[model samples]
Target: MEQANIQMTEPGVSRADLAKLLAQALGNEKASDVVQKAASKLGIRRDPLDKGQALSVLEQIAQTPGLVGITARFAKSRLHLR
Candidate 1:
């Protein structure tokens, strides 16, 4: 499988949006837990409302084992590294 290459941009979905989407995709209960786990691993606070912080959380999730399968669609076309 190909790895996702997400990019940061001004007119893209925010971290909160991404979290909510992930939650919906993974079912309600697992969503928050997943976000928390990803955030903790990324050294970001467990607040989905902060976009910048949430990006770090997403990055961490992207690096995790089996996470690519869970969040591949979300990871697509959303992140751009400098």
Candidate 2:
């Protein structure tokens, strides 16, 4: 199974939601690339909200250039917005 698929099996958050968050935060095309890069740097698969790694991955993404626009508040509000 894909890493994202495995991560999505639990609950709470879904891979699609995580992807949407990244896409919105970083902008679609860029977000896709940024997520892949962040995943590699974190030594984790491209599963942003994977178990215990979610927050850490998000933190790393937030530190990336141009991603400061993505705030914790925005992430929290995402579910409600959907």
Q: Give all candidates' CA lDDT scores.
A: 0.57, 0.55
Candidates' TM-scores?
Answer: 0.51, 0.54
The stretch of ten residues in a row with the least summed lDDT in candidate 1 is: 73-82
- lDDT for 6 in candidate 1 is 91
Best candidate (score: TM-score): 2
**In model 2, where is the ten-residue run with the lowest total lDDT?**
64-73
Task: Tell me the tens digit of each residue's lDDT in model 1 across 1-82.
Answer: 9989999655544455655656655665666566667666666654333545556666666665574444734653354331
lDDT tens digits, residues 1-82, model 2? 6555454364444444555676765566665565556556888765435544555555666675554436533564554453
Off by over 4 Å in 1: 1-18, 46-49, 67-82
**Candidate 2 — which residues are off by over 4 angstroms?**
1-16, 46-49, 67-73, 76-82
Scored against the true structure, residue 55 in model 2 reaches a CA lDDT of 53
After aligning candidate 2 to the native by TM-score, how far in Å is the CA of 19 from where it should be?
A: 2.3
